[model samples]
Target: MGIYGFDLLIAGLCLLFKQITQLSYVFSFILLFLSGSVIPFENLPEIVRKIGLMLPLTQGVLLGKKIVFEDLSMSAATGSSDFLWLVISSLVYLTLGVLGYKKCEKIAKEKGILSHY
Candidate 1:
């Protein structure tokens, strides 16, 4: 998760994405926007919030807000409904995203997608 909740997990994902694309800058903007990294999840449209849940950052931001603004403790948050979603989403995003990135990297290398760059 982007939570940096686990430093190793985030570092692993960065490696996965870097392996798949040379467009980290562009991806940063997309992640920031779609993951609610820069905005509140509640403020997002219904469809977007749904999609945003597929990205780890959204859960991270939500959890962060709960800690900072709501004064929720780490242990308490881990027991809340929101934390349940965060855990579920983190599992889904990290597992699938890493595997998908590996597959894309293989295909992209075979196709020479970035050979010229």
Candidate 2:
């Protein structure tokens, strides 16, 4: 689940930076793997842990692990409330990525960088 959201973010970024090297997919894969195995947020310091929690991958991994390890029922694992939160987080990321990309494009256009396109 976390990987899914992370993939979405990376895909979005790739779309927004199509002219640049397409590394988001690989980067997201590495990040997702790290999120799951290397530095589980539980092992992080307080502030770093909080920052980790804000990441979509973290939320997805936590929810997924709870379901897989604890035998939590789907209803329990993806309760309406919890699902809504996931949706909200995804939407927020999507919105921010799109707006930021648009702003960058606008700046590039104003600076004539976009003329080459």
RMSD of each: 5.4, 4.3
Clash count list over all predictions: 0, 0
Q: Among these predicted structures, which one has the highest lDDT?
A: 1
Q: lDDT for every model?
A: 0.67, 0.62
What is candidate 2's lDDT per residue for 17-58, written digit by digit as tens? 555444864675555554554666577678766666666666
Instruction: Estimate the overall C-alpha local distance difference test score of candidate 2.
Output: 0.62
> For model 2, what is the error of residue 50's alpha carbon versus the real structure, in angstroms, after optimal superposition?
0.5
Candidate 1 ranges beyond 4 A from true positions: 2-22, 104-117
Candidate closest to the true structure, highest TM-score: 2
